[model samples]
Target chain A: MSMVGGRRSLVIPGEIIVEGNFRAGLNTYLENGKIYSTVMGLAEIRGRVVSVIPIKSYYIPKVGDIVIGIVTDNSPTYWQVDINSPYMAILQVSDALPRPIDPAKENIRKYFDVGDVLLAEIALFDKLRSPLLKANGRGQGKLKGGILVEVSPAKVPRLIGKRGSMINMLKKELGCQIIVGQNGRVWINSVNEKLIDLAVKAVKIVDEEAQTRGLTERVKKFILKGKEKIDLESA
Target chain B: MDEEIKLIDENGLRVDGRRFDELRPVRIEVGVLKNADGSALIVQGRTKILAAVYGPREIHPKHLSKPDRAVLRCRYHMAPFSVEDRKSPAPSRRETELSKVIREALEPAILLEKFPRTCIDVFVEVLEADGGTRCAGVTAASVALADAGIPMKDLVVGCAAGKVDGVVVVDLCDIEDKYGEVDVPVAYMPNKGLISLLQMDGILTMEEFEKALNLAIDGCKKIYEVQKAALKRKYDFTEKLKREADKSEE
Candidate 1:
């Protein structure tokens, strides 16, 4: 059955959401004037565009996206980084450094020690090749002294919000510096222990209610209440 | 077995009291396993199969990695205690052949080229087997793959039909499969109206064969409905929880 003009309708794999004159969006496919869901998700219709937001999925690497990765293995010229994706990515010394370094003179592992977390950009991505990482950009490179919180990759967009408004709110209200990676890793750095806990809870809420309408307002209320509770405890 | 024991009665109901066009009761549950990327359990009559999907991850034995498309691997295994008589734990030749066909049946529906140099593994374990385990396995694996959020053109549903007591039946149970004239199993993509798997054993007249094929396709369409419902049930629960969370903010 066609589900055109339906708002927030539940869809499963192989169910047709629209027939003809509509474009398929994320987690959907088009065939013979029909848009079919490729995953179990909530279908949304806006104008002539139809899309399904999958309830669960893993991160897929894309070029120019910033991701938090942990170094898994290191070579003389490159290191294998785990971005929590199905494929392991390679971070080359050339892309990570401003200038090429001689492997004979310097050890690559020294630059990115095994198990070290770092923020990097996907410099090159091909389906057949492991994603290549570059960490030379501003606010990139090694992450230091912060707890890493993992959320769903699909919710990352919501966590960042429109033009980074949600993230800015958290940073301003909580007095913390937060970096969200497209790969679903969030690094929270702050001096106040209670504030860090509150930030974590707020991010969790955003991830949980990412699909809900008016979520930005709800999350703002949730974080404010959490902050109030922390202040009351301190007093 | 008594030779006089009729497989079909004068009223045309089979041994299980189902009409020739009626199918055995089937139930599907998705996301049954916590660890697998995708999992589903399908109970079709007396047969039960659990299928799990993993990866689109890096391929082991690097030489097996395909540059243009992801490799598809399937393992169809029957547990030792699943049957009346205990079977061997080792993969049998029958299982190896069924695994290959199951892979071929599902490969076309998946968007493998989108993720190359990786492998998508589907493991189908027959927890119970009365008959038509291969067909049930294919159906369950397809659901598991979709549950894993692997992009696919359509869901593949499988069903079996056979001649029992000189009549074509929609789905053949264990007894009918053993004494039936012919058993034909088909894996079909309902939306695309394409057949991915077709296998027949025994004999049938051309007219009977055509009739059996039509019956199995009809059965597959019914099965397609069940698969969609199972997935919808899962996501509906998720939506409900999200709404509850939103309401709590008031």
Candidate 2:
């Protein structure tokens, strides 16, 4: 009996394979073994087909990513942050350059306390697992003036949704500045305390309704309805 | 400690305008993950917890055996950015302790003897840390397990009550947690009506603690309803699919 012996023989989730040399039926003969092709498409198994699907995109730090991290001490060069997974992310001083600086400043804490929250991004994560981050970008910096909500780090993607539709909707509806730490902490800031509550409510709505189709519309309706009630009561 | 900072005024109103013993809004969803055996995301007040339960399957590493009861491993981790201050990358000592507490809390609720020698790993990731995370973890994990179809004595609902200033408050928020004098987190199996995990931090007068504990239990009962609703919603889809299959066969 011939057996398929390549990584391509296995199936990986969240991947699509196009243009194959195999036959065009629902089942394909690969390396002389019959393999089932999903009605959706075919995809190569880039990694071991683990239970958890691998994140396809380069890890971009969104407003909320619950990432576990460690402080690797600070330096004039950069403050190294070990965002627990293979990559080590860096919070560079240059990103915080525009802020006021003391010429004699030695420690970066004036900008970011050594162990303070480094809400950052994966600016560059190479094959070597070295990740450089830039907090200088909009909506990236020390999480302040808001409440933090923590959920399962793994669920961050579901909360974010395809193309940031989920979080953006929450932000727009609640009128809150939501910073999602890749480490899974979501910082919601708003002068209106009720807005903070609304942001939290919207997040929960998104989390619960992630799998549901047309989630954005549903969440928007929920928020708008809730807001209408709040507005009516105030009026 | 700022003595003047009041959680509740003499008018019987709270900082958030909630009456005593009222929980913040709660929402729950089950089977949220496509890969895990079962998964749930729960939001209680502002705190959100996502839990994934994998198996009563084979044990990894080929060792660590009990020969009878299934080995239950629980890991409770906070996202590095789950707090106002970005948290450290490593699972801190506190998270480890919380993980153990959650594991112990869930142990009794799961029917371990049924899976004999297999292992069930419960992974809880706290994307945000408001307060009552351990309790949230327990609650989320129980729902995830049930979603995964693991047999259990009952669903566990984790809840917390605390003495803020001098009065008891159910489901304390972050500010209440920072200013509050005492916090009591409790995990209870709503179906079986038993407390499985209990932990307290900060100082509470015995009467205050008792009041908080009772309030926490009550909160657990309330949350249990949400858990049941979420589970029902999760399985209802599958039931529909099964019915469709039966209809097609007929």
Residue range B86-163, candidate 2, lDDT tens digits: 899798999898889999998886667655546889999998888888888898998887666555556778998888
Predictions in order: lDDT: 0.88, 0.68
Location of the lowest summed lDDT over 10 successive residues in candidate 2 chain A:
A49-58
lDDT of 1 by residue, B164-208 (tens): 989999888888998888899999999889999999999899999
Docking class of 1: medium
Candidate 2 interface RMSD, angstroms, 1 decimal:
15.2
Q: Backbone collision count in every prediction? A: 1, 32
Give the runs in model 2 whose Cα sits over 4 Å from its true position.
A1-235, B1-4, B237-250
TM-score for each prediction?
0.90, 0.50
Name the candidate that leads on TM-score. Answer: 1
